[model samples]
Target: MKPITALFAATLLASATAAVADDNLEKLGQFKTTGASPEIPTIPQTGPKADAIKKTLAKIKLPSGFKISLYALVPDARHMAVGPQGVVTFVGTRKNKVYAVTDRAKSGVADDVKPFASTIDLSIPNGPCFSKDGFLYIVEQNRVLVYPAAEFFYESPDVVAVPIVPKGELIPKDEESYNHTARVCRVGPDDKLYITLGQPFNVPAPEKLELYKKWGIGGIIRMDRDGKNREVFVNGIRNSVGMDFNPKDKSLWFTDNQVDGMGDKIPPGELNRATEAGQNFGFPWYGGGKVRTNEYKSETPPANVVFPQVEMDAHAADLGMVFYTGKKFPKKYQGAIFSAQHGSWNRTDPVGARVMVTYLKEDGTADKTETFAEGWLTSDGEYLGRPVDVAMLRDGSLLVSDDFAGALYRISYEGH
Candidate 1:
């Protein structure tokens, strides 16, 4: 929230100039000093994998006038960022790759899917978002990288990438773990980078609570575009993988996955709203909603702990979300919130793996929650696909990324 530091401003200027001066730098994929580039492979778009995803689409149910189809085949697709020019959609994965899905023909389906900046080694790059002016920021497990004009330079193997938060600086290296390390980010209306940092524990140790609180683990942090004036915007989140700013109010809204190990139906998932900075969404103290976790049941919670605007079904593992700002959707869905439920991992009976819609009241609070699209869970308790993120294309169509099936599904309104 403070002014951008002078050092960061200088670095930003230097990076900006270097990113645009493409001719001066001799590069090979990730190696700017060498001429040898790594072999970049493209994801197969037509094959058994695509066929399987298309077959599963038959079971998906949507409201009248809505239809769903296969968009792209991206392995381990966890999150998405639609290019400002609408030429490509950069999909991030939990593994080591970020894919670029292009609809060059202007067709509904993607014409090509390949690794974006394949030379760069990315670790747990689960979040990729673009600023309005076309800067692409990819949030990895322990670092953050920005690609100036990424949509334009992504076709080349050696796209210009500058690190905003270098390795081990996003979080303590000792605290890094595979669990809860998939981060999601959004460039807020204030032009700041907002990122979620999930604590790497089912329930954080009491001694680590203050440490986590201080570094924004299990919470969201915001900084200037150049990675300056970084501060904890909100704390006390269990692990939120999805968030978006409300177009009408510019307030931040996100989904939080609640604690596990409680009974299947006890602690509910969360869809929270933060109207201002420095707010706390109860985590260790209260798992979700008013349900208190055993770890902090004896201790008192912080004052003014903001509760969720909507308490979702427990263990749904709600992930990426987006506000319906497109004109293609019906009037009732104009300002609604659409989010993905990654489904329950260890529940008695599998639940979720569907898309949900939350309609907001006039005052910007949640009015009701409803199932927007479903059928990923079969009658035999099998998951056809687990939806992880939801993004909007320029045409007002919705793109849902399923990590389970390694595909992206497109939802559009065609009318009855």
Candidate 2:
């Protein structure tokens, strides 16, 4: 699938989300960074980016009282993680460096972006998870690498271990079949490492969709921390670039990408709970609560096959998810899920590209979804940036990274 051109997103955001949405976009002090901003107002302040930054920030729409502040300027920053103290780890495309940014809460915004490890580059590195035991694990296209939490910011990286593909499963081989963003390998409740393997190919051709469906081309895989005892945890799942372990019951949950070219308003993306190992969720069949055309004779999955609990807009590319366990926000935000939608390239309505909050039920299911942060999509659908992941600060505020902008933003509330 081609990257959603900025030109197409402009039209989609207008007729699609504008009519059905309720939240407002927010405007922080914007910089005249090079991007789209034709519909925004003029910035009032004067500085290096007085015009562009103020204008972009002013045009932002959010949920009333919340405001955003630019945190740090990164060059090609991707997924990130917060370590002990205020240490922040970021994956930068510039010279393939994994940088660490640290600051004390009392010090506030003065915290500078620190360099954790460099002198090497990893291929499209995705997920960066910190183990409770003080180790940082990041996944590369070919394998998963673990590093000492202490050595992350000060010294060169030392590869601790690398996980291998399962015995019978069709994990990606050498350079011949390098998958994009193998994503993060998380430590499940049982201390097992759960790695999300995305689909190697795009929507299967009509004649081959059914054949690949049973082959389990895309889904979740679990293994020991040292890369042993691998098993297929679930099947019938399209690409799940973002996934996490539900803290309440230790169940696995993930957001799946829906196939495109099936036309608008059908076969939407999904937010699913992997209730049990080996459970099957509809993939090539039903998506985002809507049915799509398939060559399969039945097209519909068996009743026993579980569908998503909450379906998202088709192609809304939900990435990086974490449950709110900190006390920085109001009590209402506790135990909820915060996910970053990288935005959509295929949909007629340019959905996602912002961070969203889905309040979980007492039983740990999504009760309602709310916009935690906005500004990724334009009223006319032009994309200013795409949020890749959300890292929670110890103080309860959130640190969001935009790969497009190569920058980080912090969102913290002032009053109750």
Please state every model's RMSD to the true fold in angstroms: 8.5, 13.0
Give the worst 10-residue stretch by lDDT in candidate 2: 22-31
lDDT value, residue 274 of candidate 1: 97
User: How many clashing pairs does model 2 include?
Assistant: 19
Highest TM-score: give the candidate number: 1
* Count of clashing residue pairs in every prediction: 0, 19
Model 1 regions more than 4 Å off: 1-34, 37-39
